[model samples]
Target: MWRLRDKYAIAGVGYTAFSARSSVTVRDLALEACGGAMADAGLMPADIDGVVSFHFNDSVPAMAVATGLGLPGARYAIDYQAGGNAANLIVQTAAMAIEAGLATNILCYRAMNGRSGFRLGGGRELAAHGVTQYTAPYGWISYPQAMAMWCRRHMIEYGTTSEQLGAVAVTCRRNAALNDRAMQRQPITLDDHQASRMIVEPFHLLDICLETDGACAVLVTSAERARDLARTPVYIMGAAYGGGPNQGDDLFDAMRWPDHSHNYARYIADDLWASAGIGPDDVDVAEIYDCFTYSVIMQLEGLGFCAPGEGGAFVQAGRIDRDGALPVNTHGGLLSEAYIHGLNHVVEAVEQLRGQAGARQVDGAEIALTTAGAMTCGGAMVLRN
Candidate 1:
């Protein structure tokens, strides 16, 4: 097992109150959340010496560290990735930085005003990519539509139903109702979900995630120092990531994948379990990304939560509710929570492990896991108090 697994803990997790406007620019937004996280951990900006950020992050950490919250030049700065998978990558990078003794304190974050700033319509750059140029122009317009094609294909092959899909949306919406920070606090029933208009053949608008402008940051410190901090310290037991294999975008590979050409979560899940020596059954809650409702269902199978075909039945049985055996996306998730591009899910998972999730707290949640998408990108982490 990697020593970093138990060497570092997430001493602090922070986010600006998620909003469409945030009443602040992207840089100020990051500073607010990063400040909150530092205060929560009983530290000041000067305490940090290493930073990890996305290549496209509007609110650069080292810049923030210098301007408002000053830190001397960082010992290490990583622009390793910029995708939904950023949350996990940040944690992993922080652990490595700490393990190498490059810095005693590591900060990782993401901030965006993309929502109040820009509509979720096709970017000029994306128009040239396959999600639009090839697949979308051929009628796969939105992500929900693209995902619905995959979900419908699964249903055709495995007999999944609309109710099963609706259950995923309902559970996430209900989870939102339990969370004050959730943007969409309103709850929905099976009938409400079913009655919702279809954006895609099998997906309703309710199945899609909200676009919001905000920022989230996490503080990583030595596990021992974390234990001495102000609040619960959720230990990063393990973290790992993977993307499905690809050569060219061949028809045979497409046939094998149909969804995305690979099983990212399955690979990452195996990585986490092997490194942490813990299996899926040991996890108490899941904060897997919900960019689309069906993504959660697909992750259930890929992450070993249930058998491939049993995913629909698994969710439909209320097994993912707060009281259920394995509650998931308990902080409303990206679907209902403001999607600061999926960073909030990481914060929520840490909160769940720390027993600070307030109204949405899972009982005795000692272990939690989460994932984010990067093309077919996926990653998992095991956290425990």
Candidate 2:
């Protein structure tokens, strides 16, 4: 239904190696990824006219790079506020900008030295969020705890088991072994997962995602330019982001959903699918956000791959494994890969579409959808050739 198809396309993508410490500053990381992307698109720095990404990025570094790249008359510097979703939302907005003749070339990026920077693992301070403030400051700490709380609830109310949760982590490590660029390249088994230390009550060390220092960037421009670039252009087939009114909540307070007693994940899935004109079954590959292992299972069912209480069974049956119908997180995901606010998953999906993913490449990935979630926050995008 949306007619902006050929108006804009992702011409290229680039990412710094995912690692705990890359020995580079955020400024160098942004430039590395951006330079790679521009080369991939066969575009010079002067070709860009606009830029978009998260507000968390260091602004001075990017401004200097824009001037260094010599982007001619770059006017719009759009900063979408929604963290992980921010990158994809920028993609949507960039498409709009191109359609409106506001800008011709746009770039979306998320770069951070989280691991070595000392900010990520420093302390609890994120409680600025009302619910997190109440819970996190009281020793809830960071992600695994917050995510584990959600996991424990699912187990309590729906009879979920730890083994079912381990399956997600195990499969991701298996996939990571296939992705050389992944931070965690060592192969892992279920025993390895179970043997890992427990970070939170219901979540193990393996259940947690990797915190690494890295950056990823993508170049988006008109489809015509995409054709003139290095490879087949992955089109932005469908995208949608929503909150409140219908769900009676915001992404900030994910558990506040009034209906279905906290079906927040399902609510995001409903909106994303409605806008895409496709469902879980139509997707060739999926790169769902896995900030925590259980979250992947939670999203699978929430996005309608199976029934609500059936997610555990679905994954336990190897349905999400590489040989399974829906090979998810084919790039190792945030669990084994770096946590760049879920932008890596978007890059992986684009690679899957381009057939450039080496050993981990899906046989014939034409259409894929990626979903990212953080409590009340989540976003999805569809891409095709």
Candidate 3:
């Protein structure tokens, strides 16, 4: 196991109100979230020495946010290349930086105008690249089409049904209703999910995540330093990030794996557990990435919440409800809540651990598991109170 486990902790978290449209630029959005986080941690701008962010270079960079916050120039600033699946890397990288004595009081954040500015799913000129050469030519132009293909395969092989998937959407909306910061707070029922417009054959409009305009930030420092912070410390128990075998290779060729139905989470689950010295049984709450309902189901299976092909049944049993065996996405998640990439999931986990979540708080959340996406690349982190 790594000595770094539990060495660094999240002292505070903050976010801007989620919305589909925001007049401010992404830079301002980042400042709002960072300022809130700084205040929550009781830290001054001069205290921060490091920063990290992900997704495309289009979003505000780490240095830009640092400057906006009036910080003494950062000693370590990184702009990671991966997208949503690499969200947890921001926290993990900051932990390593602090452990290495390279910096202290790192601010990790993500901000974007996903709806009004750069449409995440907007058409881009294909570069005729490696993977694009294989799939894009066959009319698999968007994530919906690509993920739909995977969901269809799961349905055929595992007997997963659209009704089972509807349960995920229903659960998220129910959670969103209790969160004032969420963009989509209106309650939704499974019947409403079925009645919603179809984005793809098996996926409905409600099944997809909202294109949100928002920013989320978290403050990380040594666990000892966190003891002096304004908020209770949430320790980083475990974390891992990497690609899975056969992911995004060739749809047909990738199917030859022994467990082809599995996602990248399967590759990192053991590392996350071993590093934390805990298993699924120790988890009090989960914040699974829910870019789509089907993806959440797949992650549940991969994370060992249930056996393979049993995810649909697991969710159908209400095992992931707020009061169920393992409450998941208690802050609405990306499905109904605004998508600030996956940083909001981390914030929610911190709140759950600190007992700060008001109505949506799980009764006694002590160990919270927050995850990024599946597919080609992914990450997960275990946070403990």
Number of clashing residue pairs in every model? 1, 1, 0
Clashes of 1: 1
- How many backbone clashes can be found in candidate 2? 1
**How good is model 2 by TM-score?**
0.91
Please, what is the TM-score per model?
0.91, 0.91, 0.96
Candidate 2 backbone collisions, by pair: 251-376
Assess each prediction's global lDDT (C-alpha) against the native. Answer: 0.76, 0.76, 0.86
Q: Over the full model, what C-alpha lDDT does candidate 3 score relative to the true structure?
A: 0.86
Task: Flag regions of model 2 displaced more than 4 Å.
Answer: 1-7, 55-65, 125-133, 244-255, 259-264
Please name the candidate that would achieve the greatest TM-score relative to the true structure.
3
Candidate 2 Cα deviation (angstroms), residue 285: 0.8
Of 2 and 3, the candidate ahead on lDDT is 3
Better of 1 and 3 by TM-score: 3
Report the error of model 2 at residue 96, Å.
Answer: 2.3
Q: What's the distance in Å from true for residue 163, model 1?
A: 1.6
Per-residue error for 124 in candidate 1, Å, reads 3.1
Best by lDDT: 3
